[model samples]
Target: MGNLSRLLKESWTLVEEQQDKVAGYFYARMFLSNPELRDLFPTQMDVQRARLLGAIVTAVQTMEDPDRFEEYLQSLGRDHRKFHVEPQHYDLVGNALLEALRTFAGERWNIEYDQAWRDGYAVIAKKMMAGAAADTNPPYWNAEVLAHERRSRDIAVFTCRPFYPLDYRAGQYLSIEVPKYQPRLWRVYSMANAPRPDQTIDFHVRALGAGYVSGALVRRTRPGDLIRLAAPMGSMSPDHSSNRDVVCIAGGTGLAPVKAIVDELSRYNRTRWVHVFFGARDRDDLYDLADLNAMANKYPWLTVVPACSDDPGFDGEQGNISEVIARYGPWNDHDFFVSGSPAMVKATMRTLAGLQVPSIRIKYDAFTDG
Candidate 1:
């Protein structure tokens, strides 16, 4: 690690213990210093606070790999365009962040730490601005909802057509802004199918009490509704170079990206065997069973297993998806794709590790804000 990386990691270790306080301080300082900027953020600040701290932590953690760090910053910079972020705003935010770190650091804050952060922030700002400048596409795309189907009480599947062509790979995700809600509030959702010539995309949304965007999408959105979609982001996708057998595990709405990968595989008529485990709490929660089964039937190389944790009467695998996957065992040779709630993903990762799967063979996009 470089000097700046070491400084950032050391300072972050101190701030992480009081992460909530530091995030609260940073936003408080920002809003207080520039009241007009408050309008650009969400009305509820809790999730936003967590997101800010998480982003900083991730940036620091990845700084050791310059290529990865630059890519992440570029993506973040491009995505921030949707929020109407301007070049001047970066300086203001950086100042507030340094102030927060200083306040939290107390006597521990030194000239070296301050200088290191300034240098680091400069590098971040330059790369982010460069990313924004290089973008040929519009900051955001206007999409009209073409279809909205409530697959279950809490989950809905939406198909939308962008006013302009949206170019993305099979397993990427897009940040969507619903104007009816907080105008600037955005949520990320995985594109649930492979890119098509028509420029239409599918998203599977599950409403959570704290998910304002998801609630609006599942309950208030309808056909003809227009929403804004940011540029596609995420690096989760199949490794086409390797024809190894694939194992996909999804929980709840996490099925979206998994379905997208499978769609791509089916379209290409891939010869590799794919084992998919779809997990739900009950039989009623298996909303996409028919479609998945249909796909499995059409693609003989694909196997779809629906596992229900609470439904004993269901005539299929009975257990949490991760537990069911454990029963199959010996997944050391297969490439694994996992998605769902953080708990589900973490649990499945543990199961995969127990099965001796190499970390490099496991792939998923866990950074998108949901």
Candidate 2:
């Protein structure tokens, strides 16, 4: 590694060691100096701090070579662009991080350390700007509920008419905000339906036992209910056309986003093979079974497999979805997408690794425990 790369590696290592403290000090400083940022964070400041610490630590630790690390940083920059995180925000974060280092490292902090950090910040900022420039912003979506169907006791399918023209690529998510809740809770829900410029956008929500907005969506939300939503954001879409073989592993309501991907891809002129492996607790919990069945019937290259862990009277593939997927065939031949609980995602990822599927081709979204 070059001198700059070596310095960065060392700095990142130090940051990792003091990750928790750095995260705490960083957020505290931001909230203190810039009161505006205080509201952007959750009510549980400590929890948010820890989560941020863990994410940064994971990102830094995974970065072995500087070039690869820079690529990861660029991706992060692009993701931040969707949230409108400006170049100034990087400086703010860096300042707070440096303050934490000064506090923790004490006498070791020097002019040379500051200069190195300044150089790093400049590099990061430039990369972030470049990423932002390359990003193709998805159309913003906002609407009022037009129709809703209770597919199951826990899951509800909602259709909403866009107040304005809406456009979204398959597999992207909509940030649904419930303003009624104090601090306003926002959760990303994948668009359950294909893009229709003239029609309603759909979201399939699963109830999580008084899960704030989820509970509201399930039992109380009605037609004509105004819902504020941000446009589609996420790279978990059908990006490669030539790569035909596709495998989708979905659990519970996690199938919502993947459904959009499959639905959109089915409409394409050139036929591509797709295997959807859907899982739920039981037959009663499964939604869109008929729709998937229809797709399989209509498209020669599409296949739907439903797996149930505790089938009881039911009879299908009786096991975890990942195990069932492995039993079917080699996972290496397809682009795999997994969406569910973090534990489920971890297990599915391990299964993919064992099957020799490349990590870059496998997309995942762990609905983070907030």
Candidate 3:
């Protein structure tokens, strides 16, 4: 397994920088050899290309741990049902992937690397197949946008309800397909609220970069707009059994999952304290502070602290959230859940590390933005 892991990781290092070329080659080969499979994907190949490469990256990441790797592959397989992926398609993709890697890996590629990836992909396909077969849930659900509110120039809050109950944990993230976008194009968002009897989901979207789905969701979606939601996947739920208190940090729309976990904690918590640090660049970006205050007012065990890095007029914690956290007592002993843009999460993690927070005590959704 060690040699296999080394060979896999080494192969990735050789091609990751040239991923665009690799992805282009893989897809071109597939469409050229099996044109029928082209109908299974979206008209715009941009999102599909990134997703395929991302899936391979994820698979390689988990290769070190057999159980974790298998579980991830199975979950991925279960999720891929939404794409109508078949067993035969897996073989098709595997061959294209090998060809792509070999072409880009150049002289560094050897029989050992080829055989390792082949064996690894076989296990990956088998596990994914088993997972898809075991799932009884629909590949996706038709949802109606119940409400849409533009909180800022680039941000929107949407309330949507699936036609059927969408069973998911409080903090899990789900991929949503919008009718306004290309057919079958999907983007992931954290469900901002805990499950209600009504089963409505709240999504907070902010247009970042050239975020295609975020732009569509923020600017174009309207009430009564129909959407599709794929299965939920994440593991950021709170541990109620732990005696330690909890500290949740969030920035921008990353507040979704942290808020859901806190909302979930409200149902089971008795004595544990929960401290929430919500931060943004300016006052307008801290859009959920009022709502968080309302939650804090209702729950005696929860505390919400608002921070603004660029708002000089702000009377609250007027610094980066990571800096504000330092003023509070060292929460190194508390269970930590952090979410936000990848950059914000990275800075916060570095701060937590400096505060002597044990790695095991920290948790965050590393791939929410990916």
Candidate 4:
């Protein structure tokens, strides 16, 4: 490992136990040093602190692979532009980060550790600035909600039309900022349809406990509501060039991107067999079954299977989605896509691996939140 990486990993192990404290200290120091910068962030600091710490940990873990680490940093920088982050802000953040580390390290702090952190932060800042400079598109697109349907008590599907053309492939996600919910607070949602000629996008949102943005999106937002969308990101799109059959496993709202991919396939009249296994807690949770069934009826190449984990009286596939998938497969030769809560995705991936599916044949977005 590189010296900087080693130093960061060592220091991180010590500070991780007090992550909340370190993040609070960092933000407090930053706001104190530059009070003018406080307005850039949301009023709620709890989620913000967790996000900041999580990003740092992810960057540190990716340090061993320079290419991936650089790409990750650049993407992060480009995404931050939507929040009106500027070059000068990077300097302020870097300084605050170093100070927090020093405060936490106390007796463990030394010149070598300080220099290493400085060096690492320099790379991150430089790449992020470069990424910002290279972007030609608008920082964010303003979209108006055209329609909203309450699919269930907890889930809502929204169709929005952006003022400008929002170009994105199937299975990509966009970060949306709803001003009415909490101005400047952004949350990621998968685009639930393939590219439409009218530049209309669809999002499926499920409100979980204390999900401030999601609750507002599901229950408060209505037609004519304006929302800001960041650039489309994620690498979970289908490999169009591959002729192999596909197996998709989706749990809950994880079905969004899978449906998008299926829609795209239908548009192209793809001949390769496509099987989708949709899982939910019970029959009532299968909010999109009608849509899926309609798609299956129209597309000869697509098949939809609904599974329930908790309903004993349900007639369809009964079990966890991963377990049900394992029952149907010798999925060794098929391309696999799994999306769901983190635990579901992880378990599905393990199941696929046990079936001897090649790692390259399995594609998923690991960054999605439940």
Candidate 5:
């Protein structure tokens, strides 16, 4: 590509050999220098270090491929916006990274190599700054939860005091806090309703096998639960100005964010051409069908498609939501929004890729991991 890109490629060739120590030193140095950041991380530093190491390796690998490296970096740059990571954070990280490299390189470490690494970090920081500025980003914890509702066994909706007084653009989420079995447990839930300042936002939480907070929230929490919360996050909202066709695929409580998105579309009188595919088990286990049905009837622009994987009476569609999308055919023109269990999100994303949808247009809200 260019001088910086070529330098990046050349330096990264040594990454595979030094990957483990690079990540190790980076964290060890950073945590030592700024002990405050320790609270931002999981309690188990070793485990979290491994995770960061893996993530760094993956990121470096992606950068090695020049085809769409900028686009991928831009996506990560956008993601960091949710954390409210600033330019100073990058500078701090870069210092730690270089120190780690120097320690690992030992006698071999030279000023020239250090300069290259510093230059690389500066390039990435500049790009991240540009992306942060252009994205119209907001703070991570700027909103408070006003109210919530229990729609089904594992699905609940919460109303939020928006950081900006306006309607949520659909498919967005809020980071929230709840009593945790662990030392610190905070999670995110998608808004199930359109932006309604006077009312509560909605969230659908599917209890995983042993989801302590989710189970308690679904089974125990009530109207006036004093919930700790962050502002709305995620970039999966639909653009109202564009009439490009859209499809939503959701499973379990993944429907919460999808429903919020659909509700937003309905408010703009843009529902008819949109198709929503929701998958679940039996009738009793199904969530928000009634609300979705009412929306469909109210707006000619929308179509709700529910699929049951196990219900014998499921007369509409059978199998996974992604499968339903495939059978319908011609998804090239439509943007795909996927949410659900990690497996469902992963599988549906694969299916969408196989169907040839542009990566940018295919969005997902990973609800379970929070």
Candidate 6:
């Protein structure tokens, strides 16, 4: 690692454990320093605070991959346009971030760390600014809900059509805002199917504890409702260049992106095989099993395995999905796409690592809008 990456990482360790406090200090500093900028954020800062730390962690993690780092930051910049972020806002953010780190790091922080952060933040801001400037698309798209189906008490599947041409890969995720329920609060969900010419997109949402956006989306959203969609961001799409068989591990609503990716694969795949392991806590939670089975039936190259962890009566695979995957594998040669709750994703990734699957062969979608 370069000196700058090393310094930034080592310094971050000091405050990483106290993430909440560091994030608290960050927003406190920003709002105190520039109270006017507070208008750009939602009234509920909990999700925003988590996203702040998540973004930093992502930036730090991707620093080793220059191409990925630049692409992700640029996409983030374009996505942040909906927040009305401007060139001056980046300056304010940098100042607040540095102050937050310095406050949390206490005596452990020093000149070298400070310089490394300044230089790193400068690069990050520059790339984000460039992305924002280069983007010609609108800050957000006007989407009209065309279909809404309740699959369970907490889960709903909804489809929307953007008024504009919403260009996105099948496996990317987009943030949605329902102005009626929560105007400023936005939550992200994966595209549930491949891109189609009709410009329709699907999302599966499971309401979390006290999740305003998710609750509204599941219980209240209906056909003909108007919602806002932000630009799609993520790189966990199909890597067609390799043409290797792929395995998709999905739990609950995480099935959305995996379904989208499989849809994309269906378009051109002839030689490669695809295996989908859909898991939920119980049979009731396997809400999309029928649909996935239908897709598998239609596609000759596809295989669907539904597993339930807590439902003893489930006749198919019936353990943690990762454990089930291990029984089916020796999958070191296959590309891996994983999506689920953070805990589920972590456990699955750990299992894959234990099997000696190359880290480069695995791609996981990790985000919790709830």
Candidates' C-alpha lDDT:
0.86, 0.71, 0.86, 0.86, 0.67, 0.90
Model 4 regions lying over 4 Å from their true place: 1-3, 105-112, 366-370
Q: Give the TM-score ranking, best first.
A: 6, 3, 1, 4, 2, 5
Model 3, C-alpha of 183: deviation from truth (Å): 1.5
List the candidate 3 regions with Cα displacement exceeding 4 Å: 367-370
lDDT-superior candidate, 2 or 4: 4
Better of 5 and 6 by TM-score: 6
Please write out the lDDT profile of model 1 over residues 133-231, one tens digit for every residue: 888889999999999999998889999999988888877888888997747788889999999888889999988778888889999998999999998
Pairing residues by index, what is the TM-score of model 4?
0.93
lDDT tens per residue, model 2, 1-370: 2554556556656556777777778788877887876655556454446654454444444445566556556655655543456667777776776687667666666666666666765666676567666767532345788998899877888888877766667887766754444233455688887888567788888877536667777777888777767655665787655564888899888888789888888778355678899988899777878888998898888899998888867678888887888898766567788887777788889988888888988888777422
Off by over 4 Å in 6: none
Q: Write the per-residue lDDT of candidate 3 for residues 4-64, one digit (tens) a residue.
A: 7788888789898999989999999989999998988777786578678778778878888
Candidate 4 lDDT score relative to the true structure: 0.86
Q: Encode model 5's per-residue lDDT on 127-167: one tens digit a residue.
A: 65666667764534334556667766566655555444433
> Higher-lDDT candidate among 2 and 6?
6
C-alpha root-mean-square deviation, each candidate: 1.8, 4.4, 1.7, 2.0, 5.5, 1.2
Q: Cα lDDT for residue 282, model 1? A: 91
What value does the lDDT take at residue 55 in candidate 6?
81
Estimate the TM-score of every prediction: 0.95, 0.77, 0.95, 0.93, 0.69, 0.97
The residue-level lDDT of candidate 2 at 176 comes to 72
Residue 94 Cα positional deviation in candidate 1, in Å, after optimal superposition: 0.7
- Cα lDDT for residue 110, candidate 1: 89
